[model samples]
Target: MNKSLAASVSPALYSSKTNTKIFTLTSAEHNIEVGNWKIDSTQLGILDTYFIIEQKILHGGKQEGSKIITLTSPNGLTITLSPTRGMSIINVIGQDMRFGWDSPVKEIVNPAFINLESRSGAGWLEGFNEMMVRCGFEWAGHPGLENGEMRTLHGKIGNTPASEVEIEINETAPYEIKIRGLIKESTFKKAELQTLAELSYTPGTHHFTIHDSLTNHADYPRDYQIMYHSNFSKPLLEKDAQFVAPIKEISPFNDYAQKGLSDWSAYLGPTKDFDEMVFNIVPFSKTDGSTIAALHNKDGSKGAAIEFNVKELPYLTLWKNTDTEKQGYVTGIEPGTNYAYAASIEREQGRIRQVKPGKTVHFKIKYSALMNKEAVNKVKKEITDIQGNQKTTIIQKPIAKE
Candidate 1:
């Protein structure tokens, strides 16, 4: 560990063992706050290494009081997660590449400063700058009136703060690091949902996995939805970039998107005032229900891929927003339990998911950063194999619910 990474701490607050170590950064119930701390091989009494975990609190502007946890892996991969914002991953950087787009909103913007119900239900965009953010736990979709109540865009989970956060490390070789966060959304006479979100990363790797378990604490059955909005931009996303996936069926989400059906899988350079387009797709999966999706540059030398279980996330949404660079040029590869329609429309379409009393639902996704041609080719091949002998149906208009 680097000497400059050490922080002054009281031994009584944490364990001094050389094996696995657990740190409780914040727990309101336990009244604990290991404010602004860092740990590495030096503190663990092990061999010198670059692996380190640090937690810091931001103070200033709309980001005041936000808690950020950063994990620096030995393989030159670093990721920053915001526990203050539903444990969303804000940024990811590898030796020669970076994930995530440059959003107009520059600050991490603490949940306290965000108004999810403002702007006629589109206020969620005010604090949206994460590389990966979960959109649901209640309802995630377009803003509209559902049973006389305004359903905000993407729901409130993205703006909800985590009640507790913990960090754990493995004792043996590979030394995997896991960051866990607990977020709960409850309303009297409405619903109660608790989600345990965990992100795991191993040393010497350009990949990480996210595992989320959501349980209904309500006494009666509850309806819920979730979407993993993973966004990317330049380097991995640019002119001539291609989105590779084993498409089983696909259709435009609206009339606007229908105009770009011919070039749906290809991206364009940043254009002034570009109209965003969205495509809804059903991807082909392997016999075991696993699927892969990748976004690669023109020559396929640089890319990013996501592997997931189709049984967990049945639908995929492709979002293309190629507006001017300063106005936010980005694309989203989203997987969710349901489509990106209004909650009421999805319910009418029988796509809304439900959780029985005390029952839990699980979701797992793996993200890999491809920095070389070999890695990019490997993922493309996996997608091709899954697509074998399958005829992709391209519908001309938005899919109509039966």
Candidate 2:
């Protein structure tokens, strides 16, 4: 929001010498970095902590905008910390899509939104009206889970002292950043960075990859709903927009959409204030095809597509919140690690991935844009070299299903 960069745009970050693990800022834009920190079973003990490089952007300035990025813990396995940029809150004033941290979702037994808690057990979110944020990035269009479900990290694991991580910046690499820390009780190490780049006349786009590993040390089974809560502006999606995925049914939220409850969960609409929603999507069915899915408009113009290593996360969720009176803007495309308390009533019944101590399991998902038919034809030709050797991907669509 602040156009002036001289003072507000200088290098910035949150850091501490004590055993700290996370860093946050909200100056020019919102950014959050999950650093390495010490953890002790003794309860609030030593934690090998990490911090952000100080020279990025000053946080906590007079201006409040939007949260630029958020790096949640890979092991704690809960969506607890989300740094909103300017202002955000839950819709307590109007409609609450039936949410409670203790247990979430209405018709199903699983949770959709991430349930975050502060290190001090402080209530989630800085305020009420603006509650629960991924403290990360919003998507180009509405999220996939909006079709019927939504999700985020929901809980915290491990023990340690000092809730926030400290930071100090360096001038080297210009574009590269660094951090260090370790969660005491966590099974995996933490790595995350948040930085900004000033584009030139061309108006460049942000391109990067998210890398992490999941290791389960617990003796019992460990299931993770691994994913990114791709956010979007509902207003931008509009009424004429449409969604497509690999699955056959939608909205298990509807009491009678499928063959009995088994095949029943599917529906259609600009479902609510958030826009439209599609649930229980299938996978990209072919190598040249996709059981996952893509979205489009009434005319079959430019939209988006989602496909990943099905083993990484088999299901994709399209979520939206139309309660404009309650929440300002909410739309999401969530590729799920597990069914939304859908398909099955018991969480244990799902494919809860388990890792033996000293062993690690890993997975990754790619979220990109969707272009129109003209654009696709351009890229397809480029791929075979009929065109120039540009490697940029055109948003492709999966073949449609009945």
Candidate 3:
């Protein structure tokens, strides 16, 4: 048990009565591995007893060697994180609702068994059962060739394991719990990129935030793209479910999507052999550049939403795959620096972002579980206010160079 005092609390915010603790679950450099650990206020002299942080490793089939961290918040929100899979969130259970989809891939397949380049570069699908999975550090989009190199689907970050993971407790009033991981993607003479992924939540709240800082460790500049594929299904995603956002522009991603242009924002019941439809959107942001997108059930009573800074993530991708439940019926509300086109096409469209040597870019997003009509209505009003009087530009076809 290699526990240490964390210095995250500022002097002004630090209280003599509180004890801030940091638990190192996995750190190769520090030679620490506190396996199957759990902590609560009872062990820290804190008043909040409802919160718990637990870490364990799965040991069977493809999930073997995968490290899982479960954070049970005071508000009854439980988030399951997979450090072995780029710290992707596997489940968000709260408010008597589960926010993730039921994917055919039942196991949280460790990166060791995942072949990101298999199945025509779509092997990432084999381990894609997560509420939210990141799609890039180098390139994030459809699989395609770039300069004769095949860029696999959604890049390799999600399949890359985190080298270090730790749990930090804020001790002061609010008592925030944070799980941080260091994920890196690098190749000799090609690119060197890393991101400090942090997921934090205050006690007694239905909301949690993901704050990630990505840095280019290469001596030269590197191009990058990232998309947060936040997914939802059944209970929160029923037939006629509405994908709501304050849109500045919207367009179909391809001919298949164009056929569903009129019903793009509306979801359908799971059908046999239903192909997915993708839409590209530029969301309207508030004056400070903050924006939100939400998916509500048919009656708008139950929902889930994501808030992000549009300046950092300037695009939204709506992915509707209403296939039969057995085939994985789900939808994705993705926010990213670019649309999910092939990297080459995005580069031609001037959407691929870049970072200089030793420079880091920051991205922050908040995920909320809307438990009732009141909560869902509040978000709807926020989006309505952002829309003001602007008319959304709807394009019937893909705009990028495909």
Off by over 4 Å in 3: 1-18
In candidate 2, stretches whose alpha carbon ends up further than 4 angstroms from where it belongs are: 1-153, 157-207, 217-221, 234-236, 248-251, 254-278, 287-292, 297-302, 342-348, 371-373, 376-402
Please report, as a residue range, the 10-residue window in candidate 1 with the lowest summed lDDT: 1-10
- With a 3 Å backbone cut-off (N, CA, C), the pairs that clash in candidate 1 are none
lDDT of model number 2:
0.30
Q: Candidate 3, residues 1-402: lDDT per residue as tens digits? A: 112213222212223234666666776555566678877866777875468888888999999988889988756699998999999999999867788999999998999998888998899999999999999979999999999999999999999888678777877767888788888888998999988899998877888999998989999999999999999998988789999999999999988889999989898898898899999999999989999999999998889989999999999999999999989999999999999998999998999989999999999999999999999999999999999999999997788655
Separately for all candidates shown, the number of backbone clashes (residues 3 or more apart, or on different chains) is 0, 78, 0
TM-score per candidate: 0.94, 0.45, 0.94
lDDT against the true structure, each candidate: 0.87, 0.30, 0.87
Question: Per-residue lDDT tens digits of candidate 1, residues 183-298?
Answer: 88989998899888899998778999999989899899999999899999988888999999999999999988999999899999999978888999999999889999999999
Maximum-lDDT candidate: 3
Residue 68 miss distance in model 3 (angstroms): 0.7
Kindly list the per-residue Cα lDDT of model 2 for residues 302-330, writing each as its tens digit: 44444455665565555544334234334
- Measured over all alpha carbons after superposition, the RMSD of each candidate to the real structure, in angstroms, is 4.5, 15.2, 3.7
Task: Name the weakest run of 10 consecutive residues (lDDT summed) in model 3.
Answer: 1-10
Task: List candidate 1 stretches off by more than 4 Å.
Answer: 1-19, 400-402
Instruction: For candidate 1, give the lDDT of residue 13.
Output: 36
